[model samples]
Target: MTGTPRRFLVTATPPTTNGDLHVGHLSGPYLGADVFSRAQRMLGHTALYASGGDDHQTYVVTTAQRLGVDPVELAARCNREITGTLELADIDIDAFTRPDDVYRDEVREFFAGLYSAGRLVRRTWTFPYCAETDRYLLEAFATGYCPECLVGTCGAICENCGHPNDAGSLLFAESAGAQEGSTTEPRDVEILVLPLEEYREQFTEFYRRRRATMRPHVLRFVDEMLSRPLPDFPVSYPAHWGIPVGIEGFDGQVINVWAEMLPGLRHMAEAARVRRSPRTPAGVWAADSGFELVQFLGYDNTFYFSFAHLGLALAHGGLVEPTAIVTNEFYHLNGSKFSTSRRHLIWARDLVGKYGPDNVRFHLGLSNPEHQPADFTEAGFLETVRTRLHEPLQALATALAPHTGQPVTVRPETEALLDRYRDRMRRAYTLETFSVRQATETTANLLALLAARAAGDPGLAVAGLRVLGAQAAPLVPGLAAVIESRYAAATPGTVPELADLLPVTV
Candidate 1:
């Protein structure tokens, strides 16, 4: 927590508004971004955390169809659910935007600016069409094996390999809603595309300059992408669920939802900035805005945030290039991926309601899938809470309750513990080497250390308790606030009430 104060605009990839968020969703970018932002504030830095519901994804349309409801209505309903879930989980987002008329106009204007600059070009590509359903099979509407990993997946992107599969390019692609044995036919259509191959050299150099700070897995993925020919990214699609392309020829088409992500992020950041400084001018996206951009996303979205989005920023004359890209692998439930279609997952609100938000946050931080896939087993969760958190917290509270207002000099052992804890926090919460799991471990170690020494040296325990209140502020704000408030009111010959510090039942 000892660094030069800086300004950061931290963003989590907007959650798609097709349904309420599951634990897998909370454990990924959302919780990570929250922790990172809180840590930054603890360091006395300016960090604005911004995200919103993605209302334009094609999944919204498909889910709405399955529920026999209008797509717009379904998106609105899910957006409310997502907001409530975030609140329940104690995620402090500066701006959780939902697209309004002004937002729609801004997106169209941004796309048109890129188009007018000749950064986007028209291309003819083959698309899969289902005659029976009268629908185009693209992005959540089609299914097949991935070209790279050969794993069964949906169109547009492969979760297994973190690679993009163009519409109809998947091996043996078929319409998702087709009846048994029914197949899709190929249809050629003209749409606008971004020629990523044109920016290969620039992207290679951009990533090379950032090699030291970027994740190793992400670097490998980027090297693989640059070694092969970069595909021309589609910018427009013939669909009805997103913002209109607003071009003359593409009448019935809308801008691809992925293509709109960069603009959406920009709009959200601008909204946050305006809210923070009402007199600041709007629509300024220069690189010298004095705010560093850092984005958090899942590994499945590597191609978009690192490559496609970077390309777009470069093409627009380098407007707000990300200073850091923090990506996490998928969080699994019981050794299986959480699937909304299969209904095999735990809801965020449900988990937070059962176990308090502080415990849920700590548990998720301990099992965060940063380097590799991690599973959430109920038994493991219970054991971790009981041993790592509940027992240690209870013991510390009991030992400290008797001598709450006693004058205590800082012991040598307590000083050493505080120094090591601060060092660990400094390393774990940084943008270059961020790890929620490490942060959680640091907290657990400090708690265990303090609890083990509580009865022997009451004065040392008191000093360590002060350090714990500050160290746990970012990870468990609610509990930290209670501890800090009670100790802040400490006086000579006063015994504070600390019985409510026990862990909530799971």
Candidate 2:
């Protein structure tokens, strides 16, 4: 909150390992979280960033059904694919633990701790049960018209209408799998709920404190919910692929994927911090009081990040809730949803092959849907890549070659330009409405200006090159590396370590 945050943390709504990750998946959480983390570290702050696969989402079970494999096999396969895509794009995260991996027991322990703290209020409510399957229906499988809105959605919530559905009110049931017990009659069952009514006082305080930092859309949502009687959120039911609820007498039930997911961000941060801290030994789940959290997510999950997760934190005690929630609007592909199952979107592997990672990153950063859903067209992508990354960066890179071999005196004007560049980038620290779009534009405009000044004066070009290299450390690391290497004989310092480019949907 003051002069240089000593420690900071960034977490995103980890991608579900159901299928291929699209550009939409990239820009919303992973890319932006990477940028924020990189920026903080570059500023000399101890920033630890983490995200992982949501391996237990019902989507994974559906995908497993589609692939004719078990959920474990599907999760392992997609987890690898997702991590590979991030590495290929050079999206750096300190920890990317999975619920199916080392973090599994830790996540369960986290829930147990919260439960012990009495943060969880369990009230058995009537839920849909498929007698033939002998398990409670949930998520996509408990599909029917939303009781409140009459829109089609899962028993939990409607993505189309944003209404939280009551499982007991669920109508027609559809099986998550094509197997015999998939289609079934709904029977009444019992499940656990996290009542927001209990968290109202704490949530109001959180809402008030976060008002300055939350995005317009995010703030509005939280405020509306806090202004009313907070609704009770169901947290557990039967699921074939997930953490067991662990509450006695609820033997067969599993924790709702969303409920169990609340602890993941903290689990990741603790895992990363312990490794970085010599005194803190492994297996100890200690809270990092020094590092406050910041979360990045799409607007689609506004309710969960704003309320469900925050409420869980207040109840869990000693847990650090998010200081800011950066919510980006949807990014569509060619005026349509980018659905992986439909195969109507650009794949990360394919995009990198076609545009080169840096070009793809820069173009997508500019096209980020920060406030509203923006359509991404092939022609638009190409033009953005050309006009943004190619033309200007090429001209600047060429000019720096001859002069950057030595530490030439920086021209006064170019030094001023360098200061302006740093200031403009620091402005992105306003997390609620970060603008990769603006950052990219700033790079292009500043580089063009610096080039013009340096072209006429050799000394100015050297300073310009240094500034360019440092600036590149956050937006496009590859270019900065080239600047550092090409001018190694002349320039005295290494290139600033920055990440590659970023993108999302159409």
> Taking the tens digit of each residue's C-alpha lDDT, what string does model 1 give over 112-175?
9999999999999889889877778888888899999999998899988899997667988888
Q: Quantify all predictions' global Cα lDDT against the true fold.
A: 0.84, 0.70
The CA lDDT at 310 in model 1 is 87
Q: Model 2: per-residue lDDT, tens digit, 1-506? A: 33655666788788888886898788677788787777777777666777788888887877777778888878888888888888877787777777754566766777777767776666756555566545566776666777656876666766644546666665565544436545555454466667788878888887778787788888777766666687787777756678887777677777777877777766777666665554634422235565667888888678888888877777766676787888888888989867777788888877876666676677777778887787888899887776655655555556545543344555477667678887887776445446777777787777667657655665655566566667656777666666565555443632221122122212
Return the top candidate by TM-score: 1
lDDT of 1 at 143: 88
State the weakest 10-residue window (summed lDDT) of model 1.
Answer: 492-501
lDDT for model 1, please: 0.84
Off by over 4 Å in 1: 276-285, 492-497
**Whose lDDT is greatest here?**
1
